[model samples]
Target chain A: MRSVFRVVENHRESDWTHTIFFDREIESTPGQFMMVWLPRLGEKPFTLSYLNAVTVKKAGAFTEKLAALEPGDEIGLRGPLGQGYPPLKRPALIGGGVGIAELRLLALASEEPSFVLGGRTADEILFYEEFRELGPVHVATEDGALGHKGLVTELLPVEADSYAVCGPERMMAACLPKLPAERTYFAVERYMKCAVGLCGQCTCSGWRVCTDGPIFPASTVAQMDDFGKRRRSKSGRWEAV
Target chain B: MIPLPRIDPPLINASGILSYPEVFTAFESAGACLGGYVTKSVGPREKPGNENPVVVYPPEGAVLNSLALPTQSAEDWERDLEEIKLKNAKLIVSVYGGDAGEFAGVTRRMSRFGDAIEVNLGCPNKEPGEQTIMESIGQNPALSAEVIERVRDETDKPVIAKLSPNSDYLAVAESCMNAGADALGCGNTLGPGLAVDIRSRAAILAGTTGGISGPALKPINLRMTYEAYARFRCPIVAYGGIETWEDAVEYILAGAGVLGIGTAFMRKSTHEAAALTRDIWEGIQEYLDGEPMSALIGAAHRAAEGGDSHA
Candidate 1:
């Protein structure tokens, strides 16, 4: 069922994060999303920040409609709709900028998940303490503002087990060569519409970005069309085949 | 003398027939004269259905499926319903479940969109637990009544029970009406209908036996629709083998208030039902220009009073 629901409530700019509550309860694997379109507003896909409390940055068109929404505002949503990250017992998580939302829940869901979160400057980091309370957290900002003076990838621990990572593709590229075979890396792709998998809109390489995966293993997406060391445009739109 | 009735919104379709409404809106000329969006059946829980290789193509005209109702959980179906654009379109839900409780729950949740909640009392290739659920409730009227009654407790929506022709059709249909069902969706596919490769002797579908649909089942569907109409007054939605408006209208004359079109949605990028819908709307408009829709209701009564040839 490609469940579409109305926005029951939306919180604009809550600590610089927009929290939206939908009447549709989305039970999903951590990395899944719904292809949300607001008619004339254009369509964009978002990661599951917190199914219980969905949050988005007031960044673009999709978020703007979401930001302008009042209680009972109607929004076209199709999902809880894609494959989410596989459950991990113990894992290390890595993310940067707004991409951290993709890895946050996984950090919260794991038995004990360690995380490395980074942003442009220390002040721009999204959820620092949020990750710290969930597990041990390491931080790195590009300007040497907070914990480390380099990119967040510089702070990623050399882990030999399970890991769920979301950040700039450059960061993912730097870490891919360092990853062990047993380790799992769940990455997010943005251009998903018809999250039900019927829409070839989000097809990446041989698989569908929407239904088959929004979160795929580094090994699986290694040679695949879109995923590697480079970030799928944060705008994450699909390219014409 | 037997009595007969006329059907309206004369076609039924699979639950999730096309991905979005664009396909239906795109080709509005394919005999989709009906006024309702007959949704692919949905449940209260998210069902992943069977894995891929779930659908297969055997021949140019022949096809097989084992799409074990690949769906989001049932709760999610309701979310989809919220944004649905029915605008003057009747909404019908074709639902299936492994047990009476599951069926009841799925139906009850969707009863908010009245019109009808087609209770699938007979889905042939369900897994063990679900197969047992359908057989147990469908074969026995008392059990069937209990299942229908359970759904009635939730909403006053018209309950359209989809009966499997393989079981005792007339009996199950009567039980559904007795339990407050307003209509019947006659004859889902037959007997874990089997198909195998002659050379390999192996089953054609991943699920071994699958529901036989398309042209292969038309004659049987027509026969069953006639039989159920002959015995019961509950409205009927005839499903199977309906490729043309003429085929659909034939079911209407026989006595299906609505009809379900499956299999064919896979055939055309354009829905044949769109053509059927135009024909139906035009016929109604032309008739209303000369007489009132109320006059059509009167005609139905006259047709019923005239000895029935429909059955």
Candidate 2:
């Protein structure tokens, strides 16, 4: 519980998502997450879309409450925790839906990153303009409301020196075989309790997701037996991913 | 004193932390200096435990937890043990039950998998009815002793009764020793403490209450360990808010045979946890100046009695 209380310096909302900018800069790399706390509402891990901000999708009760918060609201943040994406030259970044939140910082830091973003509809494809401003952007939607009408994995750049994929595990798993395992990095998500190494709740194939990684090389990700199959529920039971 | 498992550095990840077999491998691979790893306390049956917000930090800088021992079943652990391997660490299995019979059943099933059986008699965060049962078992000397006897009947391995700091610890220690417990785990977290979020008008944790641990708990746990050691002279595994080598030495000096670290791990990764362990071990070695660590156990008592309490 090493949390630093900070005021929500600014907040912007768009299409069921809230991007909150805290009062100050956080010393963290792209893949690391902060355990955002809202007093009695509890804490949940969120990857920073920027060094000083977190983009949260209205997914559950916690996020729902967080969505209702304003700029002056006080919140607590613990860590730019867990391992982040390794620095790569011209890495192709692939994200699906809200999963793009984790790769935004990497895109900001990389020299020339190729972006492949997918969503159910064009509206679901977030940060389209933001990512295009950074580098070349590829877009896909299930309903053909955007760029290409298909999955994000179909548009992954095989020519990039490396790859970083985030979002649904199903998409990442499908994208796995296409990229060289040694060169591809994947940001994983799981039900995290402590957001630290203490609780084994976020364990994926014995690796503590909170500490060992929220981001791992595809080589390591390939070795995980439960990768796209199952995940531990809040009650410690295994449920389908 | 009856023989205890060989824990070279005599430090371990406290129960309720590092439960998964794979996580154990992760820590071992990272060179965690702990002599062993304690599995999360398992019961006769699997329990999912409380909902989210299981652990929290109060404004006091201490941790409050109501994990409620979310555990896999003994059967599951047996399956895990069959496949698990650790090159440099020993395994100490912790077990809990609603009563002596339930406790014994799991111990009987898990006995062969571990070097020792840590009877969790001090967990404070349980479902409504179960909480009272656990409290009574930890606080009442007779009931506590009965649980130990039942567990001892099931396993030949050393039985370490983890006592509750909120209770009459010395009485509980004596009762447990008389009942044939080989060792004592000093205590569990302090209060089923409450930390309210004024803004939300409710408790911060989903469980409403959680046991307290951290720097704030050290003195209470140290005193309990010292008192228990002075009275029973039993091998004691001391844990309470230990974060550094100085804290480690303090417990050793106070008669702790081993140390259980929990809250500190919340802030460190495996590599850092390993470093902390090595740091604590090295600090103890420097303080010992070549003397065996055992020589320092209860040394504080000896010093207070004006005996030769040489470092």
**Which residues of candidate 1, in runs, are more than 4 Å off?**
A1-241, B1-10, B19-33, B56-62, B128-133, B198-201, B270-311
Q: What proportion of the true contacts does each candidate reproduce?
A: 0.01, 0.62
- Compose the digit string of candidate 2's lDDT tens values, residues B146-235: 999999999999999999998988888889999989999988988889877665466777778898889989999999988988888889
* Counted clashes in each candidate structure: 41, 0
Name the runs in model 2 displaced over 4 angstroms: A1-27, A38-41, A50-53, A68-76, A86-88, A180-183, A219-226, B58-61, B127-134, B307-311
Q: After superposition, how far is residue A187 of candidate 1 from its true place, in Å?
A: 21
Candidate 1, A21: how far from true, in Å? 51
lDDT, candidate 2, A14-83, per-residue tens:
6788777777888898898888877756788899987888888898898888777776787778787899
Q: Candidate 2: deviation at residue A103, Å? A: 1.9
* A-chain TM-score, model 1: 0.82
CAPRI rating of model 2 = medium
